[model samples]
Target: MESNGTGGEANAPENLLGTSPGASSLRSRTESECSDKLARFVLPSMDGSPPKVLTLNEVGDVLKNIQNMELVHEIAINPEFKFEPYEPPENSLERRIKDIMHKAFWDVLRGQLNENPPCYDHAIQLLAEIKDCFPQIISQNNTRALQHINEILDIDVIKQQAEEGVLDFRAYANFVIHLMAKSCAPARDELVRQLTEIEDVVDTFKNILETMALMKLDMVNYLLDFARNDIMANSVEYEKKKFKEYLEYYKFGFPATENWLKNSCIHDANNKPCSPEQTISNAYMELMDWDESKEFPEVLSIDKERILKLGQRAKRLCTCAAVISICSGVPVISQRTENRVALAKQIDIILQGTTNEKELLDSIENVWLQVKTVINEYLQKEDQPVIDANTEDMLKSQIMQTGNKDSPVRTLMWKRFQTYFRLAMRSRAGLPPPPPGYADFKDELEAYCTALKRVIAYNHSVFGEYFMKVLTQQRVTSTDTTTSAAAAAASATESVEPVSSSAAAVTEEKSVNSQ
Candidate 1:
């Protein structure tokens, strides 16, 4: 959450904005945008002002995270998610000014009351302002509380009491505090107690107002949470309906999905006919090894971040497995505690530091030192120098070979994982076990499997029909083209001498078939 100098916190009061992406902007709009006091104010701005500035990142985070969320569903799923209170940085100019202004305001009121007969002017305004806060805290449905509050703090009635010399300003503050205790969240019970600790009328009123600001936020969050819970409870189906409508309006116009699936089909080392099941699995794999410049298929936007992270983690696993294979070749260590395995894992970390291939290639030059450092650290722990000068050269030479795309260890491990993934995509009752040499990466592979299954299952639920139609259409086109080409070749192989106009007709027929 980015904090500006204005003392605002990002993603404030979830209910202030609509739960869906199409909903207009958030925290709360000013009176210019909304007319009703309650409608205009769900949660007060960070400075208790009319409008709050939500940063770009904050807005993006809110929209992206809630883009597919059914607010009702989110609340149902986790009603306990806390909405943090906004507080300006203590050293910020806004906080300093607020503190100064609040103190000065309280001081004037205190000074007025300390005068010859106690002016009561500022006190009356403060009471009126405090009176307005009742609607902010208590629900409109709680008419009993609202009616009682209105009668007790009515400015007209208070003025009469002041003229009659019977108005108790301190009593009104105490009454507001008592009402606040009943209105606040269970979490704020301690704040009500602290307000009681301040005996000075001015000090008590000052803290009471500040505490009310906080309690208002708590009430807003609580209300927001309640609304969101009901929203989330039914959000899943609502989201599906919205997504279907979105697709239908565009005619499920997913050229990106088509391109992604087609590209995955062509990824064989040898140009062979790709199966549809394998194509889907390969497409998922492509997302993992996806090029950064290319946009992800829009249909998978919900799982975009998850797939990317999973891909990176999966890559790290494969690379580590390969490194383990490479490490065994170097004559660098004692056979006691699996030092080669430790070295491999550490080396994979360096190699997978970033997604940038060039960066990793550049860093490959220093991998030897890293490898040495890791081994030396382990060796020192065991009271031995596992890598000496000769061993360092051998380990560095073998380790650096991993930078080559064709390195035997790298190729072997990658191919094994790919085959395992392809097999994992199968739906048949009995299937082949994962390829050998994956035990070292079993945990990562399992995690990848779980994440991939979730994406595949949900995506298929939403898009299975479209994918099937597209794939079936593509298959039919390929078959017709292949059959036409084969028939053309077969006819061309036969002798067809020109035997007059009849031969001309035959030749024309052949030409049509060939074309």
Candidate 2:
């Protein structure tokens, strides 16, 4: 048995699909949720800020990529998607899996090929599977490659070659690689090279299978890119149909949406009724104040993860901006924009994936060093005197306190950011300017707001009719129940008159006896 070398895949994370920074998993979003309506995503903030549970539409730009995707199976139009080098999983479970997959299967095939008289049973099946991949990856117009595949990988000829002592596995592999090299896109040239250069027969074939998997992805993505224009053109109607099917499902409905809208609706200073659009927009904006204990409104649930991730992104920026605000409070770095940005980026890198105070404090020890370094760079660039030990100690003392939520500067900036969100949400006409002090997070706020507003406008345009239909039905049912209860109460009040009449007669008799 030959040893096949390997590596693992890197997780390609996004807030969600599409160019909008509201991240979502295109694949994951297609799943039906607990409400079993549309798929929902959970956006856990990297910093200690609150987790946002949102829906796929809330992720924004997904529908723009969500059309005629193999009739809703395996196509995505992600502008940000990139082809990355393949690496196999590196964990203990994956090691066991790798052993079973490669050691047990490929080794058995190799062992069978090298056995007395050469068994063609397993080899033929393996070749058959490999044969299937060619048609999947290549075009029908490439008649030369198709004809070559038939000649080389023909099961009858391969079986006959095995019957004689003349089977050459390397010849089949070389021939396939020759065609793969020709067919593969430029991005996959390296993969094709890796497939060609592997010396061991088993390694060569394993690399072949791996490279083919990547090639198929490359082809699909290329197809997706080519098809993206068509996808965007037709996405709205396709998404509407799919969402209608979800709504039509007997068990699935937007039970939470009616209440979410009803609760989030507000009156102006004059107590005038808000327009329906205002009502819906206000409801979506209220998601920023989400409570973890409750479920997201069903309408928003599908994009729950994307919306939350966008919120998380916004929160992460705010958190980082606050830290920079604190670090730069030393006057030298505070006055300079570059120093704050550089220092904040370094701190964010250090603080990545931290979800709470304890985890945050663990990394604070290194932040002081980042702060000092950034300050020194700024001073050197500007030809200012470098900081003394007293200044360094003062900066370190200030920086370390950021691990706490109440670090005064951090809290102050956070409050300003919160104020900004509320002010933005209050009303477009009467929207107040953002609270000052957290200006560094302005870009984050803008990006999140843009994605949210876009998602809201697009989602409402597509689904508002359906939303109103459900809301109307729910309201009618509620009003009917209320009317029935009022009728029952009125009947009980009519029956109570007899008891009052009897009490009145008893009081008259008592009054006559006393006279």
Candidate 3:
């Protein structure tokens, strides 16, 4: 019993066809039966048995037939789709799959125009079912898979496959080109190309996709710093305007924080007499590294006005830090001023302590802790609560009555009068210009600062006073509506102007007269 590897049926040729032994299978079997058998038996070869060999040529012809079925099915259904390989016993499966696919493509080229939706529908259904059962087809069948496929067919097998399917490969390709030209919208050109170049289509796509991904990553890396810079630039534009307004208001509060890392306190705390220029240089370097200088708001919501109040506050602290820098140096000139470094440390604490929501919250909190220590020891004598409460109340009142009452303006003027008067008092007695170093200046920057403070504080105070005065006058005028109402109104108007002017003049005079 010599087993001629023909496992189909021991008597397949004899039993199925009435004619005996060796009639050519391709010519004898009806195309439909061969196709049905191929789909039912050979195509779905998942059973663990080795497939019975038809004559090698016979098998090739059968595969070629199956390819036509697949394509006609695909076209009637997914006419646009190319057949992907199948799975299971990976290498063998792919070889069988590529044989069928190659024939189908050839058939499509050979003028098998399938416009019928039913065939298309069945092909779509069949391919989808096959795909579900065998998702790893191509991935499983790599280079070696192609070699195995070549073992089964002629290098020219694809050409014959196309010929038998009645396809003209070149004409089909040109037809595809014509169809793409006719397409009015973005079409699946790449997918068509993949199908046309079936053997290495997946490999090429993989490379293209990889290259595109790398390009995207490179672009993002290049733009990361720019994005960060844009954020900072926007912040600076907004913040600078606010700072300018704050400078106009002349309330210096937040100097320390903006340059904290520069002050040598963080880096060289034990060293005495740090050079101011050197300290500034070091801090500037640190600032250059920050990606957020432009990101701070131009005006902070300190009480509600869009004054660069946050920056002003920071500037104040910076100045205090500057004073520390000066003091830290003072130990060299006067042994008595050896304690200035410590005093500088105290100033750092005070400046760090004052803060609000938009302030760099953590830094402010940390600085405040230092300030608290200083306050606990040295500033114990000053009535911090009283001064703070007074300033806060005055500021709030000025804001509330900004346009509502001219009295708010008058109250500000009166406050200015008081500030100039105090400075004048300080100057007439010649009492060392408020400690540290207020003496060395021709523009009289200190006097100007003092005058500006007077102006702001006066605006705050006089407004409150005049608001109350007008309120009283209104009550009196309402009840006693005759002559006193007009007189009181006239007096209030005359008094407000003279007062604000006199106050401003006094402030300027004190500025000059004191210096």
Give each model a TM-score: 0.55, 0.64, 0.17
Give one digit per residue, the lDDT tens place, for model 3 in 1-515: 01323345433322211221232233234446445243222211223444343344554343333333322322322212333333446468777887688566535523333433112222223223322322122223355643443343222443444445543334433332343223212333454344345443223323333333333343343444345445333433333333333223222222233224224323356633344444433332332123243322111112122223432442333344333333233223124343444555454454454444234333433343443344334434444332245543443343233212134343443343334334543463432343233222212334434433332332233223323343344446544774677889888989798888999999999999989
**Model 1: per-residue lDDT, tens digit, 1-515?**
23312224333323322122232343455555433332322212333345434444444444344344433333443436556777779899999998899888888998988887667888999988888987988888999999999988999988888777777988988898899988888887898878888889898988888888887787788788667746654555665665554432123245666777776675356755688876776676676566768857766665566678767666666666666665555444435336765665566667667564555556666766776676677668868767677877876776676666467776887788777776776645533454555555566576676567556655665566667677778888988998999998777655343345677898899999999
lDDT of 2 by residue, 1-515 (tens): 00111111111112111112342333244544433236565554434555555464443322233323223322222334445655567777867776677778887877886788777687678788889999868987888879889988999998888888688888888988998998898988887987877888777888888888888888777777777768756766676776654332212234456667776657689864466566666676666546556656655544576667665555455657666766656666677776666666677787777654577677777777777777888788879888898877876777677666678766776677666665665557744554554455555557666566555655675578876675566557767987999999999889998998999999999999999
Each candidate's root-mean-square deviation in Å?
Answer: 11.8, 12.7, 34.8
In model 2, the worst 10-residue window by lDDT is 1-10
Highest TM-score scorer? 2
- What TM-score does prediction 1 earn? 0.55
**Local distance difference test values of all predictions, in order:** 0.66, 0.65, 0.36
